[model samples]
Target chain A: MLGKFIAGKFLQYLIVIFLMLTLNFLLPRLMPGNPLVFLAGEDVGFMSSAEKEAILDKYGLNDSIIEQYGAYIKDIFTGDFGYSYQQKRPISELLMERLPWTMLLTGLGLVLSTIIGVMFGAISAWRRGTKTDANLLTVFMFLSAMPSFWVGMILVSIFSAQLGWLPVFGAESAWSNYSGIDRIIDIGKHLILPLATLILISVTSTFMIMRYSMLNVLGEDYIMMAKAKGVKEKVIKYKHAMRNALLPVATVFMLSLGFTLGGATVIETVFAYPGVGRLMFESVLSRDYPLIQATFLIITFSVVIANFLADLIYPLLDPKVGSRNG
Target chain B: MNTVLSVENLSTYFKTDKGIAKAVENVSFSLNKGEMLGLIGESGCGKTTVAQSILRLIEYPGKVVSGRVLLNGRDLIKASDKDLASMRWKEISVIPQSAMNALNPIFTIGDQIMESILIHENVSKREALKRTKTLLELVGIDGERWRSYPHEFSGGMKQRVAIAMALACNPKLVISDESTTGLDVLTQAQVIALIKNLQKKMDLSVILISHDLPMVTAICDKIAIMYAGNIVEWAPTEDILKNARHPYSQALLNASPDLGNPEKEVVSIPGSVPNLVNFPNSCRFHTRCPLAFDKCRQENPEFKEVRNGHYTACFLEGVGNHG
Candidate 1:
């Protein structure tokens, strides 16, 4: 029974992946403007028609739409995502260089937000109806409503320009003379503003969500049972209430991970950091078709994979879910 | 008889936005060692509130106004959180309603029981597991089922696991609050029987809270009927059925559907329980009581012992006593 259920869930993900890839292929073609024109630019008017046809033929754009799509799909299976016309480099190599930076910032942001948000949420729920809960809730509400870019700009203005405590833009080390510990210190200093901005804006939402979910779980009869059993209040909150509350948050966090990656495009550009979002922004300006397609494909695939993992994890986190399958 | 738990004039109220809601008003009772006391009432009659107050589990907005809960001569009303934590599970425990959802779904029954043991006692994991195995066996469940998750167990088995978890620390008193309310009839009988048998073997005092009068009468030595936050009548099980002094208790007994008396119509009370918020200043039950007279509306009746070991709070009963 368990094996069949597992296999059924795996089949569901396979179907989802197929649908996502089909959409990825179709949506870009449906959008107005030809990729060849966008990539070759208006300056190409000076060139001869034969020269343009040679360029198009070279890039496989001369083929029929169906034939081109079929070949593109075939290439995808072979680990080939084509070459960037603007960068004169493989799309995979560009993505490889930038993927680590995006992961480093967003991964750190997610971990920090979850820890601080859950801690605050649990404390606020435990002290419900108190002044502390009220004050903390008010602050989170304000922070959640505030736009991320505005918060980032303000933080840079105060901490970077005014205080002169950190560098304003770029992620490079400030002290060119220094190596080892000093270089690490400079990079850490540069990261403080962007990381803090991302974490501060995102943490409030997680805190509010976790607080609401925890409060609801705390009202369940199991919490009362724990209390009646004379379990410590801390145990009742953390072990029972918080653990149950984390189920919804885990799914939400997984969904948020995808959005966080896509949403950080503006934040990355603002900081001038060499991340996937920053690369995408630059690619759009230069009309790099291969780079754009590759970036979008990578992001779309990650999201689909993340959601699949979330679905698979639900049965493990909650036994009741698995029972339903049986 | 050795009295194990005594509640003296316990009054708990909630200060809501509307008004002061009197949840449990001047309720009093005592339980002797190895005795089962049944607390019966309709919804919103403050039966569960009384149990929660004893555990000091009432959170903000609900406060114990004036109460003395003496467990083996130690007053739980004024006890610190630390003191309550120490006494809980070790001396007094509770098997809450919704037994199926009470156990952590992620954990096995063995881990959940071991957690309780580890919390109050400093024991190794192997020792706790051994104790948990014995406890599972004691509750009529196979010890091999210890590794099973809560969702894997049936409703009756889940209740049994909850009972086993409650008895993990060998508490002197165990409170089961509507533990079998939502189970099937056969499951309910099995659970009640298991509790009765366990009570006898362990010599443990129990406070059984339920809406079913017949169920309570089956397992309880003493019974208390609460109406609008007040204990209107309390007496031994046999005396309550035979000579119930309070009109409410008489109404409740009359309302109980008896299988043997199929020819007779069931008698339900005329009105529902009074709202705690903005309740009339007069006797709370007067508005619902069929035998209430002018005197009942003029003043509230005090809980007074009218017969040997039987207490009732009603103007009609008071007048009968005086007459």
Candidate 2:
């Protein structure tokens, strides 16, 4: 039974990877203009008409869409994504440099926000209609409604400019030649604003969803039974009510984590942070198709993996979701 | 008979946005030790509310405004929250209405049972677990199935788990609020029989609340017929079934199917229950009572003792041959 479940989940992820790769190939082509023009530089108006055809031929754009698709698939299997049209460097190298920063920021943001959100949500539901719940709900509603970049800008103004507590921009100072721990600290210091923005944005929605779901769970018969059985109030909340409440909220949290990934691009761009979100934003503006494709593929795969983990953990959270164990 | 559980003038009200719901009012009854008393009432009649109020488990907006739930001479209504918590499951346990869904699905039946034991008793985990196995076997479930989740069990088995949990602490009383509801007939009979056996063995006083009149007649020693939050008839099971004094209780007796009463016409109570927000100043059952008179609408009937140990509430209590 376990084997069958594992096989099915693995198969679903395989299908997701296939579709994401296909979309990666198709989405960039739909963008107007061409990366070849960017490669031709600022003197494109004076270039000969024949020179344009030569550039297109060199990049394999001269081939039909079907032939290009086949070549794209073959290139993927052979670990070759070609060079970036605008950067004059390999697309893979650019992604490797930028991807890690985004991963760290997003991963940290998700962990912090989820912990904060779920705890507050549980407390809010446990004390429904209280002043604390009302205040938290109102604040979250406002935070979620505001865009991540705007929130990032506001945070930057208050903390960096007015308070002078943390750095406002970039992963690190350009003039600093610090090494090892010092450099890590510099980057960590810079990570606070954008990180806080994304965390606030992600936590607000998760808190609302968790709070609502927890209220419903608290109304279940088992919860009442727990109280009647003389179980401690805290035990009833965390063990029984929270255990069931988290099933729905966990799904929302995972989905929102993916959603937060998308928003990170705007916040990263705002802070001038070198991450996949920033890279993707700049690549889109410059029409750097290969870099954009790599970022899209990574983001899509991360979402798929997150959902797959959720599917695996669901049986642990709610015993009624019978898989192999039941 | 020593009085085990006594509820006097109990009134529980729910303060909702729309209005104040008088869920239970002037509800009074007492259970003798080792006696199985059935509380028979239809849905929305505040039977479950009465049970919850006794435990003081009623949540927000619902308050036990005025009541005295004397369990072995201690009024739980006046008790502190700390005292109530301590009293629960040590002296009184509850088998919830939706028994199948009462146990936590994530935990094994054994763990859920052991939780109550470990809480109210000074027992180690291993000791509690051993007791859990014994409790499970006592409820007719296999001791080996202790590690099984609630979903793995049939409806009857799940109810057995709840029963095992309720009995884990060995309280003096168990308020089983429709533990056999929504089960197949055979399963219901099995659950009922199990309860009977456990009561005798444990010397338990039980308040068996259900809408199943026939089942109550078969198992309970005394029966209390609740109508719109008031006990309309209180008598020994045989007497209530043979000749109930109240109109509503008479209607309930007629609703039951018996092979001997082939010509007896089954009559459902006419008119739905009145909104409990402002329960009547007169008889709560007067709206649906066929024998409702001018006096019945003018004044609420007191619970008068018509005979020894057979009490009823109706304006025509001693007037005529009503029941």
Candidate 3:
């Protein structure tokens, strides 16, 4: 049953990627004016007519639509995302340079937020109606309501500008000549503000979801049965109750993971962090079609992949889904 | 006879928005070893509340105001947290209602049963597994099918698994709180029969809480009839059947359709259960009791023994055939 479910999901995601690829091919072409003109750069005005046709031939844009589409699909599979004339670099290379920074920032943020949020949420639900629960709820309510960029500025102003304890902007102190551990330390210090901003905005949603789910699970008959069985208090809370409550949170975690990988755009902009989100923002402004298409394609694919992982994991958490599904 | 559990003067109240709802008021009963006592009551008569209060499982808004739940002479109400934890499942366990949801959906049947055993006893997982298999077989399930999750089983099968889980650690007292409720009538009969068989074979003391009068009369050795949070009559099942002293008990028996006597009229009891919030200081069943007098409305009746092993709380029991 599990094998069949995986096969079904695999086929579904494959079709989704294929359709996305077709759209990616058409979006840049569908724009008014010639894509070859964008590819030729500002030199297009001085160039001969033969030069413009050469640019179109180089991209295989002069071929029939079906042939161009076939080559587009084949090129995507081979990891060839075309060239960015604006940056004078390959789209894939540009994306690769920025991917790690995004990964590190959002990766740390996702892990920290989920852990802290889920733990505190479980604790709050276990002690619902207490002063501690009420206080935490109030704080997270405010945190969740605040926008990410605004929170980023507030954190940056307080910790970086006012306190002078951390870097104000960018991922590192440029030209500081730091290396190894010293360079890592500089990056870490720079990371604190944006990571905090991301976590502040993201954590509350997980916390609320976990708390609501835990409260409902705590009231379930199985939880009562576990209590009657005389299971240890910690075991009851963590194992029986928390395990069951984790189902919804697991899905949320994966979704945020995918979105964060695509990049925390607003937070990244506020921090001036050199990540995929910053690159995507600039690429859009410059109308770097190849770069824009590549970044969007990566984002959509990552989101789909994350949701796929969630589907695979759901059955492990809930046994009923595995056998009953298909 | 050895008394396995004795609940004395147990009153559990729920703090509702209206007032303190006396869910279970002054409920008292004792079960002898190897015996089954059916706690019969109408809906909202605090049967489930009594079960929870005995186990001290009542949550917020519900408190056990006054009670002494003595399990084998040890007062569970006064037992410390550690002591209570150690005694649970080892000494007493419950087969909950809605067996469909009683077992964790994520865990296998064996793991759930083994958990209770491993918590209370010093045993290897292999030994626990062996015992779990025995329990499953004893409950009429295939021993090897313990790997199955709760959803894999039918409703009756799940109820059987619940019974198996309750008996996992060999608890002396097991409370089956309407565990057969959601099953079809045929499946209900089968589950009830399994419980009866287990009680006799294991010499287990059982409290079968249900509103099914005919089923209770057929299987239980004793019956306690509750009316509006109070047990109005307690006696041997035969005694309650032949000479029901409480008007409420008689009304309940009359209301049930007896398969043995299809010709017998099945009368429905009039009036819903009274709202227990700030109830008046008098016999709670006075409004529905045919023989109620000025005295019944003026004060609460005392529960006292009128005959050997027979008890009731009606003023008429003391008045000697006044009806």
The alpha-carbon RMSD over the true interface for every model, in angstroms, is 1.5, 1.1, 0.8
CA deviation > 4 Å runs, candidate 3: A1-5, A27-68, B290-295, B320-323
Top-scoring candidate (lDDT): 3
Q: After superposition, how far is residue A31 of candidate 3 from its true place, in Å?
A: 6.7
Which clashing pairs does model 1 show?
none
B-chain TM-score of model 1: 0.96
lDDT of 3 by residue, B1-323 (tens): 98999999999999998899989888888999999999999988999999999888999989999979999999999999889989999999999999898899889999999999999999999999999999999999999998999999999999999999999989999999999888999999999999999999999999999999999999999999999999999999999999999999989989999888999998887877888999988999988877889998889898888899998898887667852
Expressed as tens digits, the lDDT of each residue in A65-165 for candidate 2 is 89998988787777777778878888778877876787788878888998888899888998898999898888888888988878888999999999999
Top candidate, metric TM-score: 2
**B235 Cα displacement, candidate 1 (Å):** 1.2
Superposition error at A48 for model 3 (Å)? 12
Clashes (backbone N, CA, C under 3 Å), per candidate, total: 0, 0, 0
What order do candidates take by lDDT, descending? 3, 2, 1
lDDT of 1 by residue, A56-132 (tens): 89988798988888987897888898898888888878888778778877778888998889889878887888999
Sorted on DockQ, best first, the list reads 3, 2, 1
Fnat, model by model in order, equals 0.75, 0.81, 0.87
Better of 1 and 3 by DockQ: 3
Order of the predicted models by TM-score, top scorer first: 2, 3, 1
